[model samples]
Target chain A: MAKFDISNIDRRWIYITILLGALLPLFVPITFAPKISPEVKAVYDYIDKLPPGSVILLSFDYGPSTLPETEPMAEDIMKHAFINGVRVIGISLTEEGALLALKAYSNVVKEFENYGTIRVNYGYDFVFLGYKSGRQAVILSIGEDIRKTFPTDYQGTNIDDIPMMFNVKNYKDISLVVDISSTNTPNDWITYAYSRYKVPVAVGVTAVLAANYYPFIQTGQIIGLIGGVKGASEYEYLVNQKIQSNWGMKPKRIPAMRNMSALTVAELLIVLFIILGNIGYFSQKGNKRR
Target chain B: MAISSSIWVWIAAFLTLAVFSFLYKDNIIYKMVEALFVGVSAGYSIVIILKHSFVPNIWKPLFVSHNLLYLIPFLLGLLFFAMLSRKTAYLTHIPFAFLIGSGAGFALPLVFQTNVMAQVKGTMLFAPSHYPSLGAFINALIIFIGVLTVLFYFFFSRGEKTNRGIIVKTGIAFIMIGFGASFGYTVMARLSLLVGRLYFLFGTWLGILH
Candidate 1:
């Protein structure tokens, strides 16, 4: 083998390699099918088992910075909920998350419309409760009364006017709470909503925060979890396999699945670089010993 | 290659390229876009906070509904501005104290129940016999041992030399495994973000890929 010195490699070359690893997969046609983790499957099973018309509170707790990973998860969950006839009540605990929630809701609604099957009536089927201040306080207040916490929807329309708000009072009426966040909002949900109200909580978080939540899941404090884009892809795959089939709809191209190829390639390239660097280090050390 | 016609797409593509340019070298374009992002986000946050929070919760309740009870929170909120001045800064302490006290009081019990008590209860209630499958029983046993060893590692009172460093070594091994998993997930998270930007640039903006 030719002599190699990884330490002498330029940083620019590494960047170029990673850039190619990310970009080439986009141009080249390939499919990335990830094996669904048990954690992600747990989330799928919980939502799948919920009876029709059951209310699910989706807390969009992330901003644009984490839109890449969390948005796909949010969209997939919303799509699954809509397909299964589950009632969705959306809220954002963070100010930056408000618009993101609206965007995701609108995108999924548009997708449903494109499907030309079930038309979701806004006030009856779903409602965006909009953003509220006081992160943990808002969660606690939601346990008591949702209307009092969010007096109006995102459009300044009163919650009383919204037809769906009639029967929904608090966590009692809701089936589950799924928090898709980049922050500690999931922990707060577990603390306030799950611990106090006995409501089941699920989370879709950035991958960095995924391991932190495993202890909670092991303890049954959290019902399920979806982590990062891979987690989102798993959900998309499950929805297409199970939920979409029931709807008699063909499996569509999911953004998360499409992006997974690049993710895999980039990660593999990183691993290769690490191995090469280690080999070069050991080889240099052996030469010095000689 | 076909170019996008929409002015907004063009703008987005340009901004995306400008941001990506940072990978090669820092330039004025990167700085300009960075500044714009910060300014726009800050402005958007103010509007959102005003619309969703201040107007609904504080302003409308106090002025329109004429609820005097809202005055307490309104005044307390104003006390935050007192931090800007030295002479009147002492007034800020009252609100600060209330905030800290109320926040701590509210969070204490919940944290105890969810983070502490619930976790302990879960560990204590682990019954491998309850599992239907042998695989599940083994998994539960592994979890039980892992939790104990991890907890033992954190016990500072027991010196490492007491147990011939065996328990401490086991704890270190588990800790290393946890750190490795965390590192792996972090890499995946960052790669996912990169994939997102690439998707936007190629799939959404440029329409280079379908």
Candidate 2:
């Protein structure tokens, strides 16, 4: 047997172990039912309480790189909103998030039909103001007047032509502004939208950024946060629970929930490696001292 | 298990595998994909901006509608290109000044309110009287202590030699907690991204997961 040395171990071997740890759960699935955290429930509760036809301004502020985290969060929220008859006005802060938002909306809307829930019309019930440049400037503009910022929806149909546009003029008309972000755009929402316009803001942030927002949540600047894939899984569980109870069927696919198993096993494996590496380091140091 | 037949799925799977090939070693395939990603991103941005902003907001309204009012901002925006010439370079500052001025004019008060006043209020409002339960009181007290200590850690991160008091040590502990939480979350996030790709390959592409 080769002598085991922590410092001299092949990087490939470690990478392979981690990869196997992540991959094994996908093959023989380990189900992890996410426990809804207080922060996540705060967001869910806020959205859950909105009256039918109330508009949720969902800013898709993430790119494809974070689709694993943000996309499911967006989809879960949109599904909840649709299921509750709460309309969503999807916009994108990041350029890539524009198309990503459109894709998410389309996916949810397709599934919405089968829920046999209330009809979700494109122009009337929901509308996408789409991507506009000048991220902070666009957010501030939307605070003042959304129509001036986005003359047309993503499809280039004038906002005046859209039925829902008549009722939604600015932040005042929005029931909630949920910025799903992997960027600092949520900070802009917190500062501009919530601070100036006094609109309630919630964030669905990538897990890495979640720590940054805990203080903001404490200050009540943000109503709640859905932090990363784990947060998304918790949210999916919550949404599916309510949705299933109401309709007697869970949402067809739970991607984020599936992700939890891999996330758990991978973390556990990495922790074990870290512990073993530390033990080996101390043991080697003791030998040197001797 | 059946393999995915869709061309898009095949393209995506191939690109994903190509990117993952970096774990072994940096090769031409990775380089090619990296360049391809950048080019596609740049091209995508141009198409989105032109289709969404320039066309609807400026181009159509200026030329088709013959709206001369749009020309003011348009001409100001064009001055940004003046940076190409030495003498005309200073002209770029005109629009830059407007942008900065207007942005500051709008943002100054709001930023103060959100970042300062709100945060301060959240911190300072942690009185024991406000808490109805022992647990709530302890949580609030802990938060109050954590916020104060961590605020000082910001100065510590700048390499300032503050007084070596228990307060500073406490702040260091709070900072470590924050860092640990952040690191743990980052690990979960990166792992989730990997899980996503692995699932795409195994479940979506190969159908082996089923």
Candidate 3:
């Protein structure tokens, strides 16, 4: 180990370490056994249990800023739903999320294109409702009437024209509302959608927002949570495993699972830094006492 | 390794690098990128709102459908533009008040039901039969206790300073743990963003690590 005061270590050195930790794994990947947590499993189980043709409304409540963390979640959940015959209705409460949702859905659909057995058609299997203002209002309106909330899909196709949306009207049509959020949009969903309408809501949020939902999750207000990238990795692992077993499909190492190596290494470096910092503080304090 | 040939990819890579350049030191490139980001975001957002919300929700309904009820919100929305005029700037406050009033009115009951009543149910409905195991039940019970103590601390914090009980100390402990967990997540978030950018530079632009 290098002999240097961690407390007084240059910020650039720390940044470089993080950069290296992140960069190295991408070039030469290393992955561990993805441990599935109960909360995440709860979400997976809920979706898995939904009968074919059951609709899941997934909200891309995040943008480019938190895309790396959240985008994987969207992919995992949508893939699971698509794998089963369960349909999905994509929506975004945030403006940035609207296009991002479409992009994510497109990417997932592209991946599904590889599998000859799996087929997902736009406006039939899934629909992206695009962005709407008034987060809570939008949620409540979806509860009352989804068609009124989103008259047209992202591609400007009328809701009535979409075959899948023929029977879809409100919360009753939606088996679950999963919000992948970087912001507090999940809280709004829980408040307006879950609490008011008694709709089941799950959340995949940025790491920071995950902790804030402890009370909600504990109360069973939000049924499942994909906390952060770690949670996403768990999901990717789950999907990969299931698809491999049931469908005999080759496992595609999804982004979250792929990035887990880098994340682990980076997090380890952070832990090392913290340890060094504490040691430096203790040594300094001892010297002062002498 | 092949570099990205598309002009758009090149532009994106350049912008991503320009933003990352701040890690070394602040420079004109970073500043320019920052300015461009803010300006573009604001402009794009306004366009999106108009096309998605204004045209479809308000304008089409009021004009095409001949819905008189839509006129109320439309008129109130018009008041927002008054901010551009010094003489009529006060009118902006009317819409602001209306927005706040209605939003609060709409949210009050739902917010209460979710945050308070639901939380109470979670804390109270700690039946051992609900748990899969004793350990899970205990964990739930601990959380149940922590909730009460934390709430007690919050309510008591505004009062006298003389009697700081054991419950207050426990509450402080829980609060500290919460803050610490939040800080850890914050670190994770920042690092996640970095990993994403590096992925873009290496995987997308450089085409080495895809």
Interface RMSD of each: 1.2, 1.0, 1.0
Off by over 4 Å in 3: A1-4, B125-130, B157-164
Tell me the interface RMSD of model 1, in angstroms. 1.2
Q: Candidate 3 on A7-115: residue-level lDDT in tens?
A: 8988999999889988888888788888799899999999999999999999998988888899999988999999888999999988899889988988888888876
- List per-prediction Cα lDDT, in the order shown: 0.87, 0.88, 0.88
Q: Which residue pairs overlap in candidate 2's backbone?
A: none
- Give, for candidate 1 chain B, the lowest lDDT window spanning 10 residues: B156-165
Best by TM-score: 3
Candidate 1 Cα outliers beyond 4 Å, as residue runs: A1-4, B125-127, B157-164
TM-score of 1: 0.94
Which should have the higher DockQ, number 1 or number 2? 2
Write the residue-wise lDDT of candidate 2 on B1-210 in tens digits: 688889999999999999999999999999999999999999999998887778877899899999999999999999999999998999999999999998898789888988888888878745577877887678777888998887766665444554566777898898788789999999988999998888889978987875
The CAPRI-style docking tier of model 1 reads medium
In candidate 1, what are the lDDT values of residues B1-210, reduced to their tens digit? 455677987788788889989988999999999999999989988998998889988899899999999999999999999989999989999999999999999999989998889877766634657877788678667677777777777873266456536666776788899999999999998888878877777777778877
First chain of model 2: TM-score? 0.96
Candidate 1: what is its chain A TM-score? 0.96
Question: Candidate 1, residues A14-109: lDDT per residue as tens digits?
Answer: 988998998988899567778999989998899889999899999999988778899989998988888888989999999888889989988888
